[model samples]
Target: MRSDTCQHTAIIGAGIAGLACARALDAAGLPATLFDKARGAGGRMSSRRLPDAVLDLGAQFFSVRNATFRRAVEGWHKAGSIAPWPASLWSAQAGRWQRHEDDLERLCGTPSMSAVTRHLAKGLTVKAQTRIERLVGSAGQWQLVDEHGEHHGPFTRVVISAPSPQAHALVAPHDATLAEACEAVIQRPCWAAWALFDAPLPALPGVDDDWQAVRVNDPRLRFVVRNQLKPGRQDQGESLSLLANLEWSEVRLEDSPETIVEALLDAFQQALPDGSRLPEPSALGAHRWRYAQPDVFAGGEAVNLDYRLSASGLSLCGDGWRGPRVEDAWLSGHHLGEALAADAI
Candidate 1:
């Protein structure tokens, strides 16, 4: 139940950013309801469950850079919501594989990337499969109209945590400055393919069987993750999540999934060294993220403000406003929520 004294906030999108914002607001005793078009939360952090394997088709893994996010990650790790991933990492450079040596620690949600967002979403009111088409009513009393012609709210404020393009569409009518800011940001598309193999990947001479991920510097393939090797997923069969390069994905954005799956699989095979072979895929799937990540920040550079909060009770925050990393999305929304809560006080 919501506190009657607190102003109600309607948050659109249930990805990491939205959930992070909601968490902050909830901690401050603010009333906020999340709305997402997907069947459940997690947005890019969501996962797909196969018959015997789980694949992360969106963000494969994230690294914590900010101290605030590092603390949150620590809490999640203690709660068993996330764990370090890619026990081994490699990079395919000049047609040869080399160890990716880095001191940075990367984390992925336990079981799947969605677990983190799902954990954040607990106890928070969320309306799934509710795609808010436009904002209705006036400032100080905003209403959300969904695709089903359903009107929700009389919300005191509406915060759009969608990608910059989508957020622009929602706030254009209410606040020109917010819309312009959203418009200034640029995003890119991506193609992710999942392949479940009948057998584990063939081990290389120098690479260990535990080699979990590789950065393929091929023209077509950017990343290939051994999904089954991730923590909390050892029970599953061998599976791989193949992410295509941004340029390749953008060129073939409208291509069919079947075409993409085949292309990425071919690219993966080609990226392998001599005598290396892959097991036959038992199942294959592909997904296209129209706004996968922001390519350029607003005004061609990162700004001082982490988010945009208008006097009209309209606001915007997402990966575009910050950097493309997962930490940026969370911080953008977290700071926005903190600002809103402070205003109410």
Candidate 2:
């Protein structure tokens, strides 16, 4: 057990939101102790290394719409951690491909999707593979107890940026009102199947030179991206990542990796153009995201739920309240971090 409240905060969940929040707090000259249950810090912005290729198995790309997020992305871009994905995009409507001519600024982390979070994690004290089960203590300051029976904190403030379900579990015994609100937040599951092929899908009319990613209207799959075409990725060989739609993912959420990979692969092949052929994949694996996207069926605004800031020193922020996007996650964390910084100072 460690008892120290030296103007430091315990930020649970080292995901994008957590990392963003901690970055803001650090900017204000405050220290944060970040904790995550995963072996790495990225959370849903995950990247996986296959026997033949490295894939951005989680969030393939994000559009920078917010001024704050744009500035942050620019800094990362200048630092060579991120870059604009100029490759064309395609949308499937009425079973036909439609070239996306929006020319919007779509960006992705260099090397892999997790690179952005890894860059933001620099100079921050993050505790990986440590799950802080329940928060204990009172009067605005609480200590966190890990699953290993170890104790940490006595911090002046705590910010929880985990998925709403997990965040509710941690804050429930302490604040029922906040927990009830979190229960109302809807999140859906998703799965990404990363498949490496000896031969890529044959070029169709509007593919290759025109589009590297496509949104499928199929019931089984939602998105497919040619991983090798992205900047900082392998220039040769063929790799594809298939993201399952919300409804399909919900039904197959508990399915085996082999089952999901096979199903998504079959669906992708079927969705391809009539003359195209998908080579039998050489390497195949899948990642399951239990809390993929916020249903957002209840809110019209991006920042739907208000952040929680108790006088007792407990705070909350995440994409759950701020809608579902990388930008929303960043904003939720940043706003709460700014408020916490002001109070601590």
Candidate 3:
């Protein structure tokens, strides 16, 4: 696996795993192309723009428990890409368990989580709005075809960092072993969201504190966060945004987005005290994460390839393949990059 032999690598999906893999490959002096179906990067590390402010629609907040992830968060902090959200855990049973003012660690990207990916994508060759329908092995090289049958790439190796199901579809024909490994990875669908308000929201007993981050295990609510009171939002004036993890969202994921938004808004109102008069939100949005979190954690494994599959230039990497969290995605990508680089050398 020489550097010249590994001339090109094709990475699928421009989410955290894909971006992290691209950065790691570039750092190893390997040229790679990143492809994503979205118009822009940052899958799950997403945000929605309202009239005056932005709301984080996916991945409400993340904590760095791993050393590698901590260092990366530090770099993002210095670059002004991410900032600490001074948050305390409020649970129905625990009741505001711990509040850390000194080292409040949960971090979110400034402006929005998507900004972090935009910063990382700088100077990288990213192909957006490009969907890969299939991967074909032609003339001893891999070729990617879009839905319209447009072909791209005759590369030596391909790294799929998309969700497990999507990755399985792309690589199944070319590499059955890898595809079967992907089939073992299951992701849970989540109907989570962001709701923006015109006026300040009322403070619930244990729900709304300084920041209104609550963990409700009731059948109706899962988690809630006040976006305005989030870490970087201390200075931003009183614009209220709420994130809800609704059970119904998970149940009726295939339903229309408008229907989901309305249902979640109703649940939100019920959770509040003055429930009825809460001003109609300036904007309401719903996000359906088909693979929100991995149903089964892959432990600390790098690539769970089938023994029969050749590991020369193929790898599977993503949050589902490694651990569940965002940090796990980053670490998994970094691990896969190092493994590929080592094999290349």
Best model number under lDDT:
1
- Per-model TM-score, in order, reads 0.97, 0.93, 0.86
Give per-residue lDDT, candidate 1, residue 122: 92
Ranking by lDDT: 1, 2, 3
Q: What residue runs in model 2 are displaced by over 4 Å at the alpha carbon?
A: 1-5, 93-95, 297-306
Look at candidate 2 and give me any clashing residue pairs: 140-312
User: By summed lDDT, which 10 consecutive residues of candidate 2 come out lowest?
Assistant: 297-306
Cα-based lDDT at residue 333, candidate 2 = 82
Residue 2 error, candidate 3, Å:
4.3
Candidate 1: pairs in clash: none
Deviation from native of the Cα of residue 332 in model 2, angstroms = 0.7
User: Which has the better TM-score: candidate 1, or candidate 2?
Assistant: 1
- lDDT string for model 2 (1-345, tens) is 223337889999998889988999999888999999999799888788666677887788988877877888888998888888846788774346877778578888888888899999999999999998998997556899999989997887888888888888998998777777778888899999988888756777665553689888889988998888888876547898899999999999999999999998888777777666787888888889999888852222443444667766777788887767887787788878888777765
